[model samples]
Target chain A: MRELQLSLNQTQKVRLQRALEKLESLSSKANSNASVTVADSIPVNYEDGLLKGHGTSEFNGEVVATVCGIVERVNKLVYVRALRARYKPEVGDIIVGRVIEVAPKRWRVEINYSHDAVLMLSSMNLPDGIQRRRTALDELNMRSIFEENDVICAEVRGFQHDGLHLQARSQKYGKLGRGQLLTVPPYLVKRRKQHFHHLENYGIDLIIGCNGFIWVGEHVQVTDDMVVDQVNKSEQDDAKPDENSISPEDQGKNYTRQETRENICRAANAIRVLSTLGFNITVEVITETVDLSTSINVAIHEMLGSEFYVLVAEKESVRRSMTKKK
Target chain B: MEYVSPEGLRLDGRRPMEMRQIRAEIGVVAKAAGSALFEMGNTKVIAAVYGPREVQNRSQQLNDSALVRCEYTMANFSTGDRMRKPKGDRRSTEISLVIRQTMEACIMTHLMPRSQIDIFVQVLQADGGTRSACINAASLALADAGIPMRDLVTSCSAGYLNSTPLLDLNYIEDSAGGADVTLGILPKLDKVTLLQMDAKLSVETFENVMQLAIEGCKAVATYIREVLLENTKQLEYRRGI
Candidate 1:
């Protein structure tokens, strides 16, 4: 039996096993024997002028798999879809990364790819939301926007000779703060049409980076800062409080509400449970898991408990089987 | 002292040509890109592959191929006598180099340019043939990591003891001052990537010993393939449609 890190009681274990078995049954059988280990021969019709793709190579005049994955065929092309591998980035993928280095005119972001992606200051909209050329002074003040260890979200611009380049040209793609970042296997995060979700009901935001770095945080209105500045100036006439009267912490006046904070933690723990169960992390799946926990009155921390894992597993199995029936 | 008994069995009640039972488990290390634990009898090795990611040292970055790095360590309690061996000991360093070269031969480094792959293998239990066990574990981990390779590399150690070619030698036979031949091969390609021997053997006897080791390696390769296939299937189904 495959080991689940969580310790489960006898009944929980049985439930989990049954749910997993149901999932296995629900999956299609077309590619049942298409799984290949290292160096195993992938059956193909050589008469079709085959083109070998990634995770495969020519060995002894035979197309053999070089990785443990499922064989995927499309007309004359064949490739292996590897599981449990590092993130392979494609252009225009929304990814969350952590700033590792504040270099000259560029920031090196670790996006779980083969190399640290380079985010040039010129490529992103500055805090002022202006389209001016980046000056030497702007380079000097790069840390003001993204310094070392700051978590950021951006789009994959493209690959270059130096390394991968990222662009943050939109208001929503910039520094992410006051959030919990969860790292899961990249393969589990499928590239979908929408990676950013604003959970309106909970007043929380979920950013599912294609690189498998997920961010769950309080929702921030994605408005141009320049507009906000004008609004703040007009509101200043309404008798603003004196800055010196309050402590530095209170002066910022950016404390998150208790309800929103709880929602963030709840969403983060929901993601953790989905990752532990090795299920695909999507907005629908995550919201479903969160609702499941809330309906059962599972605490945020207790969502990782053994019984909760079993329940999630069972729920997922039932959900998948229902889809299969349709 | 005779290694083979009068009934043609070895010390541990196994035939001369028999191999130890093999067991493998994948996804043992959660943080690693790929990981596996392999056991050949009492020799247990856990391997974790961290990259095909950004190179840690910029100076060592290769332009055309990914840099391959390997580290081999054994726990103090793995041996009969608990000895605190410092890091980079001569024996471990040599073994690490051997494993790296063997793995590099099979890995398609050109596909991952400007990156580095790290393989770390630790011996938890050492009955004998830790080298072979470590190689098998690394192969499984690399495959699990989805690093492209020319073929899966499998290794085994055989010895010529009491004029018999013993497959999968035990610690007793290994330390008996007989010839120990460690062989690594690409089963599908029928090519040898690593061959090392300690002590001397006659040409005829060495041929027989090498052949026996090759057979053991092929057997290990088959088992490894089965384990990897099963793991891939499980991961696919678990991820759902």
Candidate 2:
């Protein structure tokens, strides 16, 4: 079995075991027999005209699971939901990716999918927020917009003949900077109404990519001021020669503050702890973890320590049990 | 050398039909999409599966099906001789081919078009039946990685030694210049995906040995199913609703 590789003291080990057992008991009452392994047949009523979905197949007049996972039934359709698999993209889901190649008119993005997604130059709103056909000059300057290895956030636009396509047409979706990117198993992240969260208290922007790539960074306001600023900077350059000298200093001034950086690390560490414990990562759970660490006065790095892991497990168990009672 | 004693016990004190202790663990490699450590007696193998992701080589990408690749390696200390074998030796390459073909027969490659799945298995200890152990490990890793397969492929080796068909030989009996039959089977499908034998045996005796190997494979399949079920349960319960 996959186990957490941790060195825990005697009491901590017992506590972790107790918490896990509690979690098991709480969930087992709901759907204890829903999980199935490969080649195991799912008991379905053939008379009802069942439809087999992904991770399931017909074998010798029986519906058998093709993967190791839980069997889900939605009315007449039955399918197996695989855990710990790669990100399976769905249209309209928000995702974070890394630019692997700046192609002629499209940027090849790695979104932890079977194939790299194509983000066309025409699909995304230009940095200037203008709506026009991408010109040859824009194709040549694609690297300046999103060069190789630059992290990007976009929405799944659907599949095309070439491959999966993504678009960033809104101000909320675009280049992500000043952040730490984390990857957990894609199954941990469910499709929720909101994937982008701006923690006003910590001044951190958390973009929970459906593809399992998470970005925690200093918040950048979503506004058209950057475009106006660019336009004014050009005019300033033509009007005054000395403004050019201060431009480089302006680039240096974009650095994040020390306090905000610490908060980002703290939030990132909380996520790491949650993913390691195999907990479902939601905005509420993440903030609760961060709050737990702060309330206990644990150092940012200590959030990854074994004690914190045990504590989180206990807290999650308590949270689930309480929710179950209602 | 008499591998089977008059009392019908083999050198390892196992009966002619008795197989070695088989143990399997999943997710040993944290970074791998799917990984497993499988052991049969003194033989131990670790396998990791990556991808069903982007195909690395553009020329090798298949339009209608996913490309499957495998690599087999043995640690320097895996063998008793402790010789440092060169990478991709002839033996390892042949075993890698055998494992790849065996796994390809069961995986539903057609479902994952234009992608590639890579299986890497390394022998940590070699007693006998390392090939079979590697195949079993690869199957577990593939299933653990949540790759779609028609059925779990399990393999076992049986040997004809000293006028007896022994199930799961060890290193000493393996080098006895006897007939060793390595069999891979899809238990649920009741199909044999791989069958290889070395050193000639009578046709009638070969059937008995192959049957014994099939039995061993079924035993392995049962154990693997239990392990996989337990793993699935743990993951589901831990990630509560």
Number of the top-ranking candidate, with DockQ as the measure: 2
Give candidate 2 misplaced runs (Cα > 4 Å).
A225-227, A230-252
Interface RMSD of every predicted model, in angstroms: 1.5, 0.8
Could you estimate the TM-score for every candidate? 0.97, 0.97
lDDT of 2: 0.94
Cα lDDT tens digits for candidate 2, B1-241: 7899999999999999999999999999988899999999999999999999899999999999999999999999999888988997899999999999999999999999999999999999999999999999999999999999999999999999999999998899899999999999999999999999999998999999999999999999999999999999889888996
In candidate 1, how many Å is residue B224 off?
0.6
Candidate 1, residues A21-54, lDDT tens digits: the string is: 8888777553566778878888889888999998
* Pairs of residues clashing in candidate 2: none
Runs in model 1 deviating more than 4 A are A233-253
